[model samples]
Target: MADEKGRYSNAFTATLAGIADLFRKQKNAVVLSDDDVITGKNILITGASSGLGFEAAVQLARRGAHVYMACRSGIPEKGEKVMQHTGNRNVVMLPVDLSDIESIKKLVGQLKEAAVKIDVLIENAAVVPSGSRKTKQGIEEMFMVNYLSKFLLTRWLLDNNLFNTDGGSIPRIIFVSSESHRNPKAFDWDGFGKYKEYSMGKTVELYGYYKLLMTTYANELARRLNPTSQHRYSIFALCPGPVNSNIARESPAIFKPLLKIVFGIFFRSPKVAVQPVVYFAASSDVKDKTIDYLFLMSRKEMDAKATDVENGKKVWRLSEELLNQHGVVFQKSFPPRI
Candidate 1:
């Protein structure tokens, strides 16, 4: 398995094995203890109420990191569970609805008031609507919560110097995207606002479209932020595979039981699925690995269209335009070069 360089000989084989490790009952291949990784780091994880985000927060907290759980609601109940289970009192619950841009701004204010120096930001919250829905701002719910809020919150954080505020330490931002991002349907950029009918087909396609947008924007955002080798922050987008989570609660009722069976048999649990996410969160090997769109355990290129620089630019400008319409102004540090 070792090459002349003393590294794994076949990258594909190594990648395959690494992904297989995620399905292991005990994560036997993982060697890093919680204390060996994220200790003393201030981490912020959105959507920490349940699923992968919740598990990741618990594990990180156990590692001695101060975990700020940015949840939409249920802070007290979830916060107490996190504190007791992780045995770490550093868990702080923050309330913010991603569908509301105003709530996002309020979230930033709360972060600043706490004087937290964010070392790691995990953009993990997302929703898959069973039918077409609109946020308070009249944007598609999935698009607003899954894609646009990510860009807005990230831009807000950067603008206010929310992360790496200790000045010298590099910060990491992880976007929990999905393999479903490969939806073949073309994005209807002009019709986003008028799209309000509830069809299972459209809802499913929109979910993928929104996830794909995350990669496109992340690629472009990385370009805008990392102008040189010495930038303070890096961005990574990854899919957690088909973890059995509530994200699919919106699926049609008739297939729910069948889908549940299939997922239970083949899909990994949230606890196991979160290992790779936490790995990327505080791992030394991930430092400076900027702008990689990845599968659960390996770096894989997103769909070719997702990396379209022109499309990415369009997405960025549209995001700013949308945010502005919602009474939020995006703060740009380094203007996009391409």
Candidate 2:
């Protein structure tokens, strides 16, 4: 059985390898200009206190975007370092915890009251809990923080017209997903709430499912919003490749040495990983009605079934149902075809 499983995994990974190869060959073939700096654009990036998110935020701010750094805790020293290094005066740090729906709502409400028109929202906050745990809302900690919070926040932003600029340019939503969604293992939606018995592989699989959901929801929301409005909006899912970041620290201590060694050898730096996100957030090449599932460093499109409209709609409905059960209304009306 172990041999058979290994064979199947190998075959599955091979398929993904082919797709990634195609993306790598095609990423730089397309020319993009840096003239489209997000000058005076209001942007919000979650998890900006550290890692890839911090790098992306700093880059955006340096390009003249007004960035709101939404983090779970007060400004960390690392964030100060980023600001100092970038010298971007437009950065505003805001406290937010994605696990709490009320906190998310309050933050959006504050933005609305302030009449802030957000041109770009990078849903980058995530949590890989050390052990099995539940969030304040009783959902699995990883799922709640990684997927649910982002879904709810995107919905709130769209429904409240936060993405609508005064000049009528539609905003963009960029979800920082992973390449692991290409795994062949089926998703365990029902089992997401029960995490105690999960092994490392299972945890990684769950993270893949989260990425699948991100791609699904991004495309679905794009399709839903594009046809109805004249102002253009786009959604993108970006995989930052394997990066040397603090995420590995969340693993069991026994594996820390191995993880560090492996990451140090194979992982890209956070600055390198954040380039694709910066491109998606500010590039004119990714215009209205485009849905891109990109690889890091270059704007390479990845293989994703969630890019399909039907699959995206299905995931969107299920996500809405889940959010509604948690007393967070996703507020967007789905078309009859969905």
Best by lDDT: 1
TM-score of 2: 0.85
Question: What value does the lDDT take at residue 169 in candidate 1?
Answer: 80
Candidate whose TM-score is highest = 1
Instruction: Kindly give the stretch of ten consecutive residues in candidate 2 with the minimal lDDT sum.
Output: 1-10
lDDT, candidate 2, equals 0.72
Q: Score every model by TM-score.
A: 0.86, 0.85
Clashes of each: 0, 0
lDDT of 1 at 301: 72
Q: In candidate 2, residue 58 scores what lDDT?
A: 81
In model 1, the clashing pairs are none
